[model samples]
Every structure is written in C-alpha cells, then in structure tokens.
Target chain A: MTMSEAIEGRAALALLERARAVVDPPLRTALDTLPGPLRRIALYHFGWEDADGAPADGGAGKAVRPALVLAAARALGGDPLTAVPAAVAVELAHNFTLLHDDVIDRDPTRRHRPTAWTVFGVADAVIAGDALFALALRILAEDPHPASAAAAGRLSACVIELCGGQQADCAFEGRGPREVSLAECVEMAIAKTGALLGCSCALGALYAGAEPERIAALDTFGREAGLAFQLIDDLIGIWGDPARTGKPAGADLVAHKKSLPVVAALRSGTPAGAELARLYRTPLTGADVRRAADAVERAGGRDWAQLQAADRMAGAVQELSRAVPDPAAAGDLLDLAEFVTRRSR
Target chain B: MTMSEAIEGRAALALLERARAVVDPPLRTALDTLPGPLRRIALYHFGWEDADGAPADGGAGKAVRPALVLAAARALGGDPLTAVPAAVAVELAHNFTLLHDDVIDRDPTRRHRPTAWTVFGVADAVIAGDALFALALRILAEDPHPASAAAAGRLSACVIELCGGQQADCAFEGRGPREVSLAECVEMAIAKTGALLGCSCALGALYAGAEPERIAALDTFGREAGLAFQLIDDLIGIWGDPARTGKPAGADLVAHKKSLPVVAALRSGTPAGAELARLYRTPLTGADVRRAADAVERAGGRDWAQLQAADRMAGAVQELSRAVPDPAAAGDLLDLAEFVTRRSR
Candidate 1:
C-alpha cells in the first residue's frame, strides 16, 4: 500500500476499536430480555450470534460510521469514550435503514445469509426495524451528559431526512430511471446517507465542547465525505469484484438500480442510455447482468460513475480542508475520508 | 340520561372539537404530496376522508388522547392551545400502532370500514404508518420550542414499550386459553395502550412548564385513567349493544381477544373459564358472538371488568388530586378521565 493508504487504514482501524470498546454493555443490556426468536434474529443481525441466536461468528459489517464518529470526537478535542452513545446511535440508525432497505429493494441476501425479510418475513422485519429505530433514539436519551439532547436532536433530524430520501429513492424505482443531475443526485445521497454521518461528526464535536460554528464545520466535513463514500459505493456495486463486494460483479446493473452511475449514464442519454433503456425493459438474469455491465461500460456508464466518484472524493477533501484548517486536529479524520472513499469492499 | 352519561357525552364532543382544530393541518400537509392511492387510504384511516379521499364529515372518532392533553394543560393552569403539537403527537402515535396492528392481526375492518390494509395493501399501509410516525416526531421538532427533544424522547421510549407489549399480545394469541390475572392484563394494556395516553398528559404539562414532579404525577394519573378506559373498552367490545359500541357487540369475544374482562374471568378458572375455553375452541360467528356474550355476562366477566374500571378511575382521580391540588385545575380534566372510562363509543 502507498503511504497515504497505510495511514488511512490504521486510522480507520483504530477509530473502530475505540467505538467497539465503548458500546457493548449499555446497548447489549437493552436487548437482554427479548423472547428467543426476536433475541436470536436481532443478535444475528447485530453480528453477535448465529441466525438461530446461537453463539457464532458470521456476517459482521465494518463499523465505519461509528469509526467516523469517534475520530470526529477526537479531532474536536474530546475523549472519544464520552461520545459513545452518539456513536452507537448513528451506527444503530445506519443498520436500521439497512434492514428496511433490504426489504424495500427485494434483496434476499445480506452478509451472505438471507436478508431479515427472507428470514423474518416483511411483517416481522418492519417491526424489528421499528424496534431498532426506537432503540437508536433511546440510546441517545441514555446519555446523561449535558450535550445529550442536542446530540439526540441532531440525530433525530438527520433520520427524518434519511426516511424522506429513502422514500424518494423508492419512488424513483417505479417511475423509471431517474435522470438526476450530478448535483441533485449528490444532494439526495447527502440526505439518504450523509445526514447521519454528518450528525455523527457534529455530535462528537458537541460532546467535545466545540463551538457552534466549528461543530457546523465538522458536520459539513462529514457530509461531503459521506457523499464521496456513497458515490464510491455506487461504483463498487456495479464494477467491484465478487470477493470484495460479496455479490456478483455488476449487481447494480442486474437490479437496474437507479444508482448514481446508472443515472449519470441515463442522463448521458447516448448509446449507453439506449442500451440501458433496452435492458430496463426486460427482466434481467445473470447473463443479462453481464450484458448490462458491458453495455454500460461501452456506453460509458461505468466510466462516468467512476469519474463522478473521484470528483466527489476531491470535493470532500476540499470541504474537509476548509472545515478543519488545523491539520493537527484534522489529520486522522482526513485519513478516514480517504480510506472510506477508496475502499473496494 | 344519568348525570355521568351527560358528562361523558359533553366530553366526547369536546374531544372531537379539540382534535380537529389541532390535528388537521399537520396531517393534511404531510399527506398532500403522496400518491393518490396512498393519500386516500391514509386519510380515510385518519378519519379525514372516505376511502376515496373525497371531502366528508362524521367518520372521526373521539380524539380522547389529544383531549386528555388539552385538558391536562388547562387543568395545570396553562393554555390548551399551546399543547396542540403534543396532542397531535399522541394521536399520530395511536394511529401508527393501529395501522401496524391491523397488518399484524390481518384484520379486514376497522370502524365499520375496510381496514387500511384492505384498501392500500399491507406494504402501503406500513409505509403510510411510517410516514405518520415520522410526522409525529417531526411535529415535535418543528415546534421551535425548548421541550422538543424531551417530548420526542418520551414518545420514542413509549413506542418501544408499545411494540414489546404488542409482540407479547400477538404471541399470547397462539397459546391456548389459560388463566391470566386482571392485574397482568392491565399491565399489558398500560404498556400497550396507556403509554401514549400518559405521554399526552405529560407532554401537555411539559409544554406548560409544569414542575417535573407534577408532570410525573400527571403521567401516572393519565396512565391509571387509561387503564380504566381500556377496561371499559373491553366491556363494550364483549357485552354492550352494537348500536352503542358501533362495532358488533362481543367483537373481542368473537376474535378471542385477551381483553381485561376476558383475562379476569380466565383467572377465576371457575365455570366461566371452562365455558370460555369451550367457546374459544370453536370459531366465532355472528350468532356465536351472541352466545359468547351471554356466557361472558353469566361468568361475571362484565362485572369484573367494570369493578376493575371503577377502582382505576378512583386511583386516577387520587393521582390527579395529588398532582394538581387545586380543585379549579381539576375541573374538566376529571370529567375527561370519567368520560374515557364511561363512553360506549
């Protein structure tokens, strides 16, 4: 790895470690009394148990959001440990969306096992998602420190945006491929994904006693970084290898998802748009995924998506630079931004 | 009419007046942009329209929770108008549960109309309920006041309890009829139903700047009153005339619901319990409902539930007396509690 990549990896890992150490007791204690089926399913989704609720290791995702929270706290001159509840809140909210998104997207697999919908049914999954949504807010309430309500308020506001953005995203599906402008798509992604990330950062700064203006700056930084990460995610969904993505290459193409790149390609409205239009007309199978990917690539969909992702990453870096002029306070967080935007998995 | 009946009638009318004045704007604004089908079904469910979203009147139920909020605020020497958002919050939360509950129970009708699930499909209903739920929290956020987070937190915490109670209630349905105490059933109802009611009162006090201790006491009062009200509801569901109760008499008995009266009778485990078990073993029809009602009355379920309601009403009065202290503040608020426990519809 290059020098910057090595630094980014270490920062990401270190931030995650701190978040892990701080979260278990209070969060776990909240789930201790559930019935076996709910307990097991929830635990498995939490990556703490097998699908049946038995103790086992499987399908755990990287705690990237929480890492950003902790790193942001430290960057704002606060001890990361004190911001635990806020960190946990963002992570839980992230997972809450994932649970519902899987059901909405009709994705059967997540982390290699069946999605919560496949395993628990949509009814139970919706209930479980609501449960987690409540849990996230409750976790915010548990913070006894003075900054708690502000942190909770910010998180709650961001989640409202998340729901709105998700609703818009789902609405996009039935109406045909959304020809969202590059700017508009980025803004929607900011709501869909960046709002929580930025809240995490702002929450950390609030706990660290950062001034209001600086806290707002940290929020701005996290927002851009979050958008950059989502753009990169869109690219990976379409082109990343199976080993890294945990799905067939070009899964986005197969699903005909109105991902940023696909939207970009549709907006490009060239041979690529015509090919995408044709593919969109029929049911896509495994072979069709190959053709869709090839068509998008030849039609320049893949290239546009990648270039857009890189541009977002650059924009994020510029935003971060303005937000944290003190390189000393910003170094580690900047590293995190780079790592997230560059990740293959 | 008896003196008690007149008071209840007046209170019910007052509740509707207070509810429509506060609930309409926020509910309509949030739903204005949704697709026609979604908006229509949701509006119908909220009693804002017929199933077709056309303008209508007279379908709305008594807005008991919001009335409790306004009455509590007025009783506490505060402006009832100031508590409007809290009132809306409680009502929205109630509807949120109803939408989900109908889906979980697979019930086909509510308030003599096809249920939201029947009209919109379960998926749309779920999304619509979420839309309402988010709107509840958003209303709190939009208040431009200091207590938004605290109010949201209380509502959120109560939602968690409500979900757990619902899960337990659903789980109990499959377990064969067995002895369950009136007290235990009350606890379930409180968790399942009282949380929102209690929140209504507490939120009003909070908005009015009532002392924290007073707020806690008012919450207790509202909860006890809620229990009394639920017991009364259970009575209407199983024994009252269909003309008075709106739905067919003995509806809960037909559904084999574990209402307060049913639980009380079952715990007796005497002749009533045995008769209940036999009746429960057979699928209930319209004629069967009449039979079950007779057995329920003969088994003393109606009286047991009534006596329980009397005790809870007294307890709630005692709690409110302790909190408000001033007889003047207790004026219509006491009438509200009595109305909640005595109303047939």
Candidate 2:
C-alpha cells in the first residue's frame, strides 16, 4: 500500500477506536450493577482487573463492533450520543458470547490470559455470561430513546441467531468430512460472526432514525465485513504467529476444529485434501499440528480463503456505497474494512 | 382445615391453573420461532414432546409464575390480555433458569423426565437456555404496550440478580459450614427464587399501568410467596415420599445439599446438629441418608423450616392485602400460596 493510504487507514481506524473508548465508562458502570462476585468475574474478564479484584494494566478488546455502531451512526448523520447505549450493549453482548464460547470450546486462554472458566470454574463463567446477556438487553431497554424497544428487539433476535450458529458449528465437529459442506460452514460463520456485527450497524442506524433501506444496507455491509473477518481469522488460526494472534500457532488445526479453511480444504477433493481428511479422522500431536497446517495450504485452502475474504470485502464496500451514497462519507467505513483485512496480510 | 375452607381454596387455586393453561398456545408459538434443533430441545424440555420429537402425553410445569402475572393483573383491574406477553415472558425466563440449573446442578432428571442437558448434551443445553433468555426479552420488546420497555428492563434486572444468587449458592457449596449463615442463605434464596416471582408480579402490574407503590406491594407479595414455596420445597427435598415428590427419599440428605433446613440445623448449636454436621462431612450411603434426615429433624430443622414457611406465607398474605385491598381480589394468589404449602404437608 502507498504511504498516504496507510496513514489514512490508520487515522480512520483510530477514529473508530476512540469512539469505542467512549463506551467504556458506561459499560463498566452497567456491569458493576451485577450483584456480588459476578461483578468481579466480569471486571476481570474485561481486562480491567486481576483475579484478586485489583486493577491491572489490562487491554480491552479490539472494539471493532462498537466502532461499527458509531461509524454507522455518523454515516447516517445522527448524534453519536444517541447510539452510545447501543454501542455499549453490542460490546457487552459480544463479550457475553466470548465468555460462553470459551467454556463451550473448552478454551483455556483468551487475549493472552487464562480464560474466565479456567480462573473461576465453568459454572460461574457460564452464569456470568448469562448475566451479561441480560445486562446488555437491560442497557438497551432502559435507554430513553424512542427507538430503544426496536433496538432491543433486533439485538436480541441477532443474539438468538448467534446462538443457533454456534450450535451448528459445534454439531459440525461431530460429523464426517463428507457430511460437511462449504456452504454450511459459511452459513454458520454468518450467524456466529456476522449477525452481531450486522446488528451493531443496524442498531446504530435505528438509533439515528435512518430509513429502513439505509439500515438494511448498513447491515449488509457489516455482515459482509464480518464474514471477511471470520475468513481471515480462520487463516490466522492455522498460520498466523502466536505472538500476534495471542493464540498458539495452528491452534484450530490441533483441535481438529471445523473452521472455514479446514472445511474448504477437506472438500478440495485433491490428494492433499484426502490426506488431510485422514489426519483429521484421528487425534493429532504437536508434530501433526504443523503438518496439518501445511497440508491445508497444499490443498489450496489458504489461497481460496484469502480470495474469499477479498471478495467479501469488495461486497461490503459495495453495500457501504449503497448506504452512504456519497463516497466521502463512506471513506472511514471503507478504511476500517481495509484495516481489518490488512491485519491478516 | 375445614371442608368449606378447603373447597374455597381449591376453587381459587383452580382459577390460576386455568389462566396458565390459556398461556400455552401463545407460549408454544413464541418458542416455535427458535431455529431448528433448539426448538426441539426446548419442546422436549417443556414436556410437550418425547426425545424423538413425537408428541407425548406429558404434563407441563405448575406454571405458578405465569399465574402470578395474570392474577396480579386482575388485582390491578386491568385486562389480562395486556399482560399475556408478560406472562409468557416470565414463564420462558423461569424455564430458561431450569434448563441451565439442571446443567449446573448436574441433575439427571426434572419434572419426572430426563433433563435437557442429559438428553441433548451440555453445550446445546446451555445454548438452548441462552436462546430462551433472548426469546423472553424479544417477546417483551415486541409487545405493543407502552410499558413493554420497563417490563423488559425489570425482567432482565431480575435475571441478573438470579445469576448472582446462583453464583453465591455455588460459592457456598465450596466453603465450610461456618462460612455460610442463615442470612446469606436467605438472601440467595430471595435472589434465585424471589426475584423472578417478584418481577412476574411487577410486570403484570406494569402492564396494568398500576402505580409504583402498588407494583412494589405486589412484588413483595410474590417474593414472600416465593420464599415460602422454597422453604416447603427444601422440606420436601428431605422428608417427602419419593413417589409423591418424583425424587428419592431424603435426596438432599444423600447429597449433603446445603439447603435451608440443613443450614438451619447446622447452626442450631444442639447435639443433634453436631451429629448431623459430622455425618455431612462424609458422603452418605443407603442407611446414612435416613439417619441424616432423622438427625436434621432432631435438631429442630424440620419445625424451624415449617414455621419459617408459615411466617413467610403470612407475610405474603399481608403484602397481598396491601396490593389487592379487597379480600375477593386477593383470593387466587392467597389460594396459590396455600396450595404451595399444602403440598409439603
């Protein structure tokens, strides 16, 4: 990329990050309302504190979803303050999924630290996740905006779809390679990853009193961006450096996870695909994790995922164009999308 | 009780049951919107179907919470239809807790059948519970009533409290007997059981456009009834017949569950209390279960719990009188409370 373009992208991304930072105090205050030790677990999970309830120099998440909320609000010419609760609600809902997802996946680590379940046991972790889900809805419902009810309804519907997607992903793991399809994997990814991102933008539009068509366009853009994000994430799971990813190299491959790339490779029907399938049939050790990553690439999975992500990003920009009409107004959203894909590169 | 009083009590109790039966169609329709296999698990859990999705001649729950919604609405002199969504939402929320509770408690059976987690596995059950939680909020958010937002907000807050209470209960289990107190146990019970019931009544009152003070009174009534119901339930968990309770005799004793009666006995400072505490220090066997139950009774645990339940029931009646004012309007709720305690007798 050219130097000017890189600087513009960073500026746009920084703007979104700054907008997300606006949601932190309200989000923390909302979570603090939870009675008893659950507040401690929530605070610790959000990287605000250590296990002992002491403050730590912890990092928050990427805050991409909250940024989408604010950017979409700005794109629609609405007061960003009206969308603040929506942003916080989306972030809370996102973290709720993360907490439960870690438990469901039996993941021991997140964001370079031990998972909440590992720190506080499974039952409390799950309960804390549920509490956060309720708090997210409560935050939206308590907002004084006229659109609060509709926003709460849409966000919850999105959550329902998200859970359904997670269930589908879990079910896929128990199935044979032949029983799985790329289409199914993509659908699950859309529900599991795309739904919340789409909801974030749609909620922002809703808060802005944007026209339904505009909201739909923004939702489409966010959903496509989310798909691109997931495609890149799957690639990172197999090949990205652990230092950058904050996960062990080839973590998904080692678990024989049915990620988009893995499903794509297994369906490639090449000799390498067949070999990869055989390896997946049984458990793998440390050595096999590296071999499996190479096998996926050899089966053309890496190239296909990368191409799909680019295509999805293009589609996202198309939807953004439809929503914004003016290219200049759409510039920041486009830059944010560019930055997302740029991370994988 | 006199025959006339028994007859009057049965008739009033019948009114609430009839109202609950009215909510079934709407409740089932709401659940049907859940995606694919989740709907199946939910249907099976509610005892509406067999594991294979075939219709079963099964019984639904007592629907006590739903009854409170309708009865509370009636007492406020409003159309019960206005509160139907609230009733459905509360019932859904109650079942959401049941699904997750079974998983957390690792109980194999519920409502005379295998629990959802046992039938569908843990992950799906947890996800299914989450879906119900979302669906509950969705139902309220979609309601046309102006009070929908407030009802949704209150219900979500109650759910947050319920999670905190469950967290405390779980935490207590890991601690020594001396670490737990009656006050703490009571507070947990209020949160875990009372909060939802109180929210049910409050939602109904909110739907009726009742004044805040009136809503608070109704909430207090429901909360106290919930406490009484829990006390009786704890007693049944220990001493009730297995055939009648659909559980093993002295099931809590066998598990050394720190139930209200058990905690009370352990705190009694009597010789029987010490013996019971000693027995609880080790896992119980076939004969030990009966001895434990006897020791709890000898420590005045049984009498204490029974008296506490009556006291709470009286307090519930006092609150009900404040809300209803007219004795006739309070009849159904009073009867429901009577029936709850009668089950233990």
Candidate 3:
C-alpha cells in the first residue's frame, strides 16, 4: 500500500473513533432509560461493561456507520454535532441488529467476547434488542429537529428491509448452493447491510437541510460503500486470519453460510464451481471448511468479489463527487469508504 | 347482570366488531407491505387466513383496543375515521407483542390455532415480529398530523415498558408463588397490558387535538380498564370453559403462572394459600390443575379479583365522565370499559 494511503486511512480511523466517542454519552444515556436487565444487556453489547456489571474492555466496533452520518453532515456544510442524534440512532440500531443476529445465527462470540445472548440468555437478548429498536425510533421521533419525522421514517423503513434481507439470508442457508443466484445474494446483502448505511448518510444530510438531490447522492455513496464493505466482509469470512478476525478461519464456510463469494463461485458453472457445490451440499467442518475455501478461490470467487468491491468503491466516490463537488471537502468520507474495503477484519 | 347493563355490553361488543371491520382494510394493507412469508404468518395469526394461505374464519380479536382508540376520538368530538392510522398502529403493536410473547412463553397455540413461531420457525417469527414493530412506528411517523411525533414517542415508550413487564413476568415464573407479591404482579400486568391500552387512547385523543387534561383523563380511563381486563383474564385463565376460551381449562394453574389472583391468594397467608403454594411448587397437570384452581378460589382469590375488577371499572367510568362531561356522549367508552371487565374470554 502507498504510504500516503496509509496515512489517510489512519486519519479516517481516528475520525471514526472520535465521532463514536462523541456519540457515546448520549447513546449510553438513551440506553439507560431501558429497564434494568435490558439496559445491562445493551451496555454489555456495546462493550461498555461486563455481564456482572463490571468494567470491561470489550472493544467498540469500528463505528464506520456513525462516522458516515457525521461526515455526511459536515460535507453538506452543517455542524456535525447537529447530527449527533442521528449518529446515536444509527449506532443503536446497528447494535440492536448485532444482538438479534447473534441470537438468530447462534454465534457464541463477538468482538473477542461472549455475545450478549450467551450472557443474558436468548429471551432477554431478543427483548432487549426490541427495546433498543424502539428507543432508536423514539429518539428521532422526540427530537426537536424539523427533519426528525423524515429521518425516523427512513430509519424504520431501512430496518424492515434489513429484516427481510436477513430472512432471505437465513433461507439461503437451508438451500443447496446452486439454488441461490449471485443477483439474489447481492440483493440480500444490499438490503441487509447497505440500506442502513445509506439511511445513516441520508439522515445526516436530511438533518442538515440538504437538498433532496444532495441527500439522494450521499445515500447512493453510502450504499455503494456498504456493498463494498459487505463484499470484503464475505471475503474475510472465507479466508481471514483467525488471530486478526477474532474468529476461526473460514467460519462462514464451516457454518455452510451462502455468502456472496460462495454463491458467486457456485454460480460460475465451472469445474471448481461444481466441486464447491458438491462440497456445500454436504455439512462442512474442520478440513472440509478449508477445502471449501480453496475451491471458492479456485473458481475465481475471490478475484470476482474483490473486483466487484473495487467497482463499488469507485461508484461510491463518483456519487460523493456529485454531492460535494470539492474534492478536498469529501476527504474523510472518501477515505473511510476506502478504509472499509481495505480492512482485513 | 342488570338488563340495562347487559344491553350496553352487547352494544359495546357490536361497536368493537364494527371498529374491527373499519380498521381491517388499512391493517391488511399494512401487513401486505411485509414480505411474502412474513405477511402470510401475520395474516394467519390475525385469523384472516388458514395455514395454507387460503381464506378462513380465523376470527379477529375482540378489537377492544382499536375500539378504545376510535371511541376516545369520538368521545372527544373528533372524527373516528381521522384516527384510523392510530387504530391500525395500536392493533399492529398489539399483534407484534403476541407474536414475541408466544415465542418467549413457548406456547404452541394462540387463539386456539398454532402459534406463528410453531407454524414458521422461531427465528423467522421473531424477525417478522420485529418488522411489524418497525412498521407500527413507521405508520405513526409518516402520519400527516402534527401529533404524530408525540403519539409515536408515547407508543414506543409503552412498548419498552411492556418489554420490561414481560421480563419481570418471565422472571417470576422461575420463583415460588409466595416469593411474588400481589403488588408486583399487578404492576407487571399494568406495564405489560395497561400501558398499551393507555397509549392507544392517548394517541387517539392526541390525534383529535384534545386538550392535555382530556388526554390524561382518557389515558387513565383506558389504563384502569386494562387493569380490570387483566384481572378478568386471570380469572378466565384459571376457570373459564376451554371451549369458549380456546385454551385448555386451568391453563394458568397447570403452568403455575404467578398471575394476579394466585399472587393475591398466596399473599393472603391463609391455609388455602399454603396449599395453593405447595401445589404451585410442584409441576401440575390434569386433575392437579383443577385442584389448584379450587384451592385458589377457596383462598378468596376469585372474590378478591372480581371485586378489584369491578372497582377498576368504576374508576374507568369516573375518569371517562371527567373527560367527556356529558354522560350520554361518554356512554360508548363507558360500555366498552364495562364490557372489558365482564368478558367471559
């Protein structure tokens, strides 16, 4: 990687962490309003405390989405702090999804720690997630901003779409590899992951009183970046380092997940594709997961996904350019978009 | 019951059915926005369709909550049709709770039919419930009225309280009956059930541009009615005819639920209370459930609950009188409150 790119990436990461720090107090305060156990579950899930209510260094997530909200506001010539509620809402909704997804996926760990469902039990975790969802909307609905209704509406719409996408993703797991097309998988990823990211950016722009055209442009930028993020995430799921990713190598393959690259490989119709499909039809584990990853890569799945993500990044930058006009003004969001695709985890 | 009161009850039931009919189309349209499988599950749950998606007499719920919404609007001299969106939101939120509660309670049946979680898998049912919740908030957020924000905020707050109440109820199930107090049980019931009823009426009044005093008065009326409704529900759970209630006879006793009456009975510290406690400590089925119900009755649980419900109904009527002033104008809402306390199922 170029030295200049590395410096830019570091700066972008710093911006993300700073923005997250700025939103933490209000986010925590908002969550504090939930009933005791539900609040504890949320606090634990957010890496703020332990299951026993002790302090812990359970790492915060990268905060890319919240950063996008703040960045979008600044790019639209508005005070980033004005969009703090939007940032908080997006972060809370993201965590809500994480808690529920952990339950739905039955994953035991997240961010190098036990998932909240494991600690609090599934029922409490599920209910807590619901509370957080309600809280996210409540914050926006009760906000004094004139744009709150639009923002809340968009956020809820995005969440419903996310649920639909998650349903589709779960459905795909029960099917044979060849049954799901690349188009369908991509659509699911866009809905499940991209919609919220886009909504995050658009909400900030909306709160900033940006023109509809600018809001739409920023939304497009965020969606494209989200797609890129998902593509890279799928790549990491298949072949990431366990030490770096905080999960077993090929964890998705072991779970027989119909991830984007896996679906792409199966849809390739090549000899490797046929082999990968046969392997996926059987339950996979241990050596088989490793073998499956090799087959996916051999079918050009890795290269195809990498190229697609790069294309998405390019598209995201194009959208950002249309919205911001001045290249210098768009630096943080653009760097963050690049950082998303470049991350190993 | 007095002949005049019985007539009023019949009229109230008729009003409930009429309100259910009025809200049906919009509610159905809202459900239609969900994806195919989720929509089908909701439709089946609502008694509009059979498991196979064919039309059936699945039977709408008594529509008591929706009726309260419309009746409150009318009592405040607002057009009932103007409050349709509020009615739709409340009903959707109510059903959303039912879906999640079925999963949390692990009950196989609801309304004498297979629960959604059993028909669909638990995960899908959960995600669908989440979608419905988001849709409920979305409906209010997108409403044209200036009161939409306030209504949405209140509804979300009530839901969080409901979650907390459910958490408490579930927690109580793990303890001996004597470990819980009547006050705690009543508080749980109020949060779990009364908060939504209050919010429904309050939303209607808010949408009608009612004064804050009237809104508060109507909220109190609905909450009092909700408490009475729950007290009667506890009674029915213990002794109602299975054929009419669509549940097994003495279901609550069989499950050892620390319901309001059971808590009251246990807290009485009488010989019958001791026997009821002993029976609850052990698992019960068949004749044991009937014996448990008998013990609860002998402990004065039945009489106590009946009197409490009557008192609550009186309080509800008083509140309604204060809000509406003219007794005739408040008649429909008063009848609905009375009907809630007098229901057989």
Write down the RMSD of all candidates, one decimal each: 3.5, 2.4, 2.0
Can you tell me which runs of candidate 1 are displaced by over 4 Å?
A: A1-3, A32-41, A50-60, A114-121, A142-144, A177-188, A211-213, B22-61, B107-124, B138-149, B179-184
Instruction: Encode model 2's per-residue lDDT on B48-77: one tens digit a residue.
Output: 989999987646688878888887888888
lDDT of 3 by residue, B215-268 (tens): 999998889899999999999999899998877999888878888888888988
Off by over 4 Å in 2: A239-251, A269-272, A282-300, B246-249, B284-299
Ranking by DockQ: 2, 3, 1
lDDT of 1 by residue, A259-290 (tens): 87777777776886778778877888878887
DockQ of candidate model 1: 0.36
Those runs of model 3 whose alpha carbons end farther than 4 Å from true positions after fitting are: A283-291, B241-249, B285-291
Model 2 chain A, poorest ten-residue lDDT window?
A336-345
CAPRI verdict (incorrect, acceptable, medium, high) for model 2: high
Residues A93-168, model 3: lDDT tens digits: 8888888899999989998789988998888988999899989988998899888888888898888889989888
The C-alpha interface RMSD of every prediction is: 3.5, 0.6, 0.8
Cα lDDT of candidate 3 equals: 0.88
Candidate 3 CAPRI grade: medium
| Model 1 DockQ class | acceptable
| TM match of model 1 to true structure | 0.89
Give the candidate number with the greatest TM-score: 3
